[model samples]
Target: MEIKYIEKVKKAFEMVHTKKPLVHHITNYVTVNDCANITLAIGASPIMADDIREVEAITSISSALVLNIGTLNERTVQAMLAAGEKANKLEIPVVFDPVGAGASELRNRTTEQILEKVQLSVLRGNMSEIRFIAGLEASTKGVDASDADINSGLAAGCSISETIAKKYGCVAAITGETDIVSDGQHTLLLENGTKLLSGITGTGCMCTSLIGSFCGATEDFLVAAAGGILCMGIAGEAAAEKVGKEGSGSLHKAIIDSVSNMNAEIFTKRAKIHEA
Candidate 1:
């Protein structure tokens, strides 16, 4: 899975540890614990709150902001807007995760609202989520990909992603066996990951959280996006290597362990990103 773009991603891995940052999140409950734990493991502090009163205060103080629509509700939606607006005004970077975006009418509308309300720095999600955000027809299961080509089935999902990024002026990242990231111009392809990632719940959500973690430290939106994807990929590979056969549970822990030990030397030796 080794590739040339690995070096670029590796340098970003080194920067994060040297400059620990604060990441504030207003995500769902399903993966909130893992998201927070992973953020901390990746050398960043995570604070998740949807309280309308505190969201603005917290966003104003954090290094990065994350908004996830995994478990959306009227009350929480309002909170997201409040937090995201403050993050915007304060100029802190924001990462948006449109989890299960095409799963329902409510989800689709909510995702659009988020984009309209906040100027996102990065949009990390599956093809279905990205496609839905791009104003294209898409379908999805509850928080997961539905049909296995255009939405969630394509080999390289950047076609829809590129269009979406340009429309919003943000980086769009679509993950699968190979990951695709583009700002409607340069697209980065990453190849470091394992099938075991799909066997775990909340991994995608955690990946988005890690993006915010890295963005907190480095304002380079592209590097922050690339670093999160490759670092998580590298960690998953390392975790699988360290815990050979115990199963996905052990592999998940190893992934976190690898992130806690993330560095350029380790990443450069393990990353697998390349030009698409």
Candidate 2:
């Protein structure tokens, strides 16, 4: 599984370098700039639009679509459904990020509605968010969860994520210090990210965008997810090493720089993993 993940990562990188697919995102305002920049750094084009007028049009031409509910609103939710339906009609892959799923009843209902509208290739979010989407009661504090046990959160999340993936018929990804990806029977644990990433405001949103970019270009959803996580995680580690506790601002800059310098060879060499 280690070799398989490595190969998949390499394959995804190559596809991004070659296809350079356009990823359409109906994402949040908090991470719009970062998400677009990161997508470009990874050799994928980014289009951020939520306006009902252009959302479906943009998604129709895009290679992959991403839906993020960080700042949910009536208009954006409608636009997300419209874009997702358009993308689905074209058979373009779609990725969903339920940023603050357990925060409110409205959020949970909205996520479920979106899932019913489109077939998600990958669902990316933190433990609480993923757990909420999986029909589990999770403690959520607005946009974040403090109940996360850093030591074993990944294991517990992975166990639950597998069940969620099977139930939803899509790849479930719960990201943390050690990210977990599962497709029911198969599971992969990624130990490639850095602690400093938690300091960043839009890291999770950016990861969702990154995964969308990969999904746009790669036919293999799992490979695309691994590519996004491994690449982003490695970049986070590089950024942290360069910043060294100064602050999240510096770390964010380093993350962009690291991503700009990242290539297929770097991921093939540095990614650590436990997989099926």
Candidate 3:
């Protein structure tokens, strides 16, 4: 990317600290705590509330809303719809993570329901999940991308990301060995993460949270999406360097620490983003 684009991302990253925006999430229980912590680490407040009675109230008070279908249930699905509608009426940015989208009928149905009801600012997922959302052949192995799908490479990812962005009318971010962020008109390829990032659960959820944090602080969803992905990618690299042989347990803590310590200078210098 050009220096100007990098500067735009840096400004979005710093605005998270300046605004300390409140991000409301109606996410699955599996990664809720880690999601909240990662949001805080990036200087945004997280309120994870899914009670149908209170979801609308919570979303109304927040700057951004994140909806994740990681662990889907009938009740939470209803809450997600209610909260999403409220967020839409208020013009709050919504980030949707279609976790395990192609794994089962329930997930696929829920993904479609959310897309029909909510106007997402950014739609982020793994290559398999995004491909599934784009109505393509996707092999999703219970919330994880199949090896064959992961090996599809950047060219395929860029096309799918753009297709989804145009179809959904939002920024589409497909995260993998190479993360692709596109808003139809412009696409960015980011290569800054570690393979070790896949060793742990909730990293993808955390990445979505980071994106929501940046989205909460800025109206430019494209830059906000890129900034958030870049933050998680850089943090993973930093954590991998520190953990060394200690394994995923240590890397988990170090990842949060790196996110908490991330600054504009570090983000700008270390980001491996390019325009496509």
- What C-alpha lDDT, on a 0 to 100 scale, does residue 220 get in candidate 3? 99
- Regions of candidate 2 where Cα sits further than 4 Å from its true position: 148-154
Clashing pairs in 1: none
RMSD of 3: 0.8
Could you give candidate 1's per-residue lDDT for residues 222-257 as a string of tens digits? Answer: 778888987778888888888948988898788888
What is the TM-score of each predicted model, taking all chains together?
0.93, 0.96, 0.99
lDDT of each: 0.82, 0.85, 0.93
TM-score sort, best first: 3, 2, 1
lDDT of 1: 0.82
Q: Which candidate gets the maximum lDDT versus the true structure?
A: 3
- Cα-lDDT of candidate 3: 0.93
In model 1, where do residues sit more than 4 Å from their true spots?
A: 1-7, 150-156
Q: Candidate 2: global Cα-lDDT?
A: 0.85
